[model samples]
Target: MIYIPKMIFHGNPLSFGQYFYDVWGGVSYWFTSALSVAQILLAALFLSQRDRMTFYVGTCTLLSLLGIYLRNTLPSPFPWYYQTGMVSTLLMSLGGVYLRYESRINKLVSKPYVFGIAAFVYLSYVMITNPAHPQGTTPDICMYLWKYLTILCSIICIIALSHLLPQAKWLEYIGKNSLIFYFFSGTMLALFGSITSLLAPDTSYILTLTVTSIALLAATGIN
Candidate 1:
């Protein structure tokens, strides 16, 4: 579908290699994000072994930091290992494993609000100071740092907020179908151009957001 439009409208024919890379090779993170749940379950097998669990988490934490550092420091077009999101999967999956035991950690269970507020504030600070920019072929170290901090902080905030709003059925429904929304979101975004093309070139961001949201929900529902 993507290839046909570029060839017909843009008069730019994408080679098979390019199309494969664009659609699959470069986007391993999209799939790995979901597969990380499998990794979480495997890690849970060691729940009874305290020493091994601590070692695994500690090692993954260090590897996560190392992966971030290497990706930032290395030349453009990072190695397949870095691009495949192995480090990120380990980080997130291990974090999930740790969260299973969070309730037992008296400090975290007792003062969840404090941690949540701190995460919110730090996330706000990063958003303000390190405003996102397009990550080109060779992005800066700050871009890598910004992404890591934003993800970690966002996760913390979401986990904390989940405890407070545990009974929102609407939210639960949305969460249940999040993957469906994710899968079709790009198609909706591409379709959005038809609506935007009818309006002024400099349409407001709100209009784009509104139409995209409606189109995505409609697509999800139809699917």
Candidate 2:
């Protein structure tokens, strides 16, 4: 997966799909993606059972697959709508797992405050060092840390929110069709980008970002 980005940056001629199999220089990205999918499936199976350890392991596996798949699947030129569909599916699945086994998870973590503080601190670090921020110019020491922190925060947030909101019935319903949202995000992003680019080829980044945000909100509403 890392190799794909490297090759793309280095001007590799292969199309996005072909690059997944370009293993002459190293591990084929395609194989990595496949392995990630298999891991997700395994995690889903584990989480579906009543065992807490199995559930934890499986959830991690599924998320790892999602990260890998998202990075590898550029989904550009296609409407951002498609991307949304995919993400929606993933989120919905995770939500379902939470709905079914959150109580068991809370028992295992047993220290919400500790996890919450950790997540907050990590989120702060990420905000401070994000590449988009002025302070982020110091070689991105916190960039990698931020990625891990965000993942941790996401898990903690989900658990905490589940307790507070307990009515994830709606989220669970949405989760059931998360793939549709994922697909929508991609398609919408692509469509919006294409139209905007065509209309404003020299548009500023800020403008593009604003448009993207608006598009995302609209897509969310649609979902």
Q: Tens digits of per-residue lDDT for model 2 on 80-195?
A: 22332333334445556767887886775457686668668767876776689786253332453355456666677666666676666657865776655654555566667767
Candidate 1 lDDT score relative to the true structure: 0.58
The candidate scoring highest on TM-score is 1
- C-alpha local distance difference test of each model: 0.58, 0.56
- Superposing all C-alpha atoms, what RMSD in Å does each candidate have to the true structure? 5.9, 10.3
Model 2 alpha-carbon miss at residue 221, Å: 13
Which candidate achieves the best lDDT against the true structure? 1
lDDT string for model 1 (164-199, tens) is 664987677768878666655655666665667577
- Which 10-residue window of candidate 1 scores lowest in summed lDDT? 75-84
What does the lDDT come to for candidate 2? Answer: 0.56
